[model samples]
Target: MLTPVTDIDGAPFWEYAAQGELRVQACADCGELRFPPRPCCPHCQSFASEWRRMSGQGRVWSYSVPHPPLLPEYAARAPYNVVVVELADAPRIRLVGNLVRAAGDPLDSLDPRGVRIGQRVRVVFDPATGLPQWVLERA
Candidate 1:
């Protein structure tokens, strides 16, 4: 399980994630959606915001494998996969997360080399964090 750094703008997103729901900030004014929670909508610059639940479905917009483990905490889980997922519900927004338990093994294990672009993925949750993480959307 990965611990998130919570900020004023991002806390709500994590809270929702902990509840096994994927939520993004939607522009209360123009209806534009965004991730990485911000004070205002990037499209309309609206300060108003609300939570919109996602279908927990998306595609791998981009991905990479980190070599030699970037942090000591991850050394044990080396060669893990990190992905920038573009949600099917809102293409403009992408969520960055590790693709853990998508196939097998611990979620923290790093194996970025096995990932592919445009691959279908789905959300999975770790009970330890009570958050909606990600996994391969199996056929």
Candidate 2:
């Protein structure tokens, strides 16, 4: 299992995901939210922070379908779609994840050709990875 490295600052994120919730670190002082959790707030340099729950609704800000020569773990899913989802509540907060068919599905479960910029998506917890993945919302 190639799980994400859970560092001191980012461990809570994975914890939340394991609980089936999407959360991001927010500056306790300025209420500014940030991803890839850090010790200090980038907005106000506040050392105080807290995890805030997210709506889990976002749009595909961008996407990419990787070609060959990928890392060994990803090579098997070479043609999978990776998407940057811009959170609806906090547009500035974008998260990268694989767009899959459903919760706990494989990364390459969705067809690459089906992904599109600006497509609506919703978060889903992948129990296998203990992470938040995405699934396209029905129109």
- In model 2, residue pairs whose N, Cα or C atoms come closer than 3 Å (at least 3 residues apart or on different chains), thus clashing, are none
For model 2, residues 1-139, the per-residue Cα lDDT tens digits are: 5587899999999999889999999999999999879999988899999999999999999999998898888889879998999999889999999999999888789999989999999999888888789998888
Q: Number of the top candidate by lDDT? A: 2
How well does candidate 1 match the true structure, expressed as C-alpha RMSD? 2.4
Off by over 4 Å in 1: 102-105, 108-113, 130-132
Give per-model TM-scores. Answer: 0.86, 0.94
Badly placed stretches (over 4 Å) of model 2 are none
How accurate locally, in lDDT, is each candidate?
Answer: 0.79, 0.91
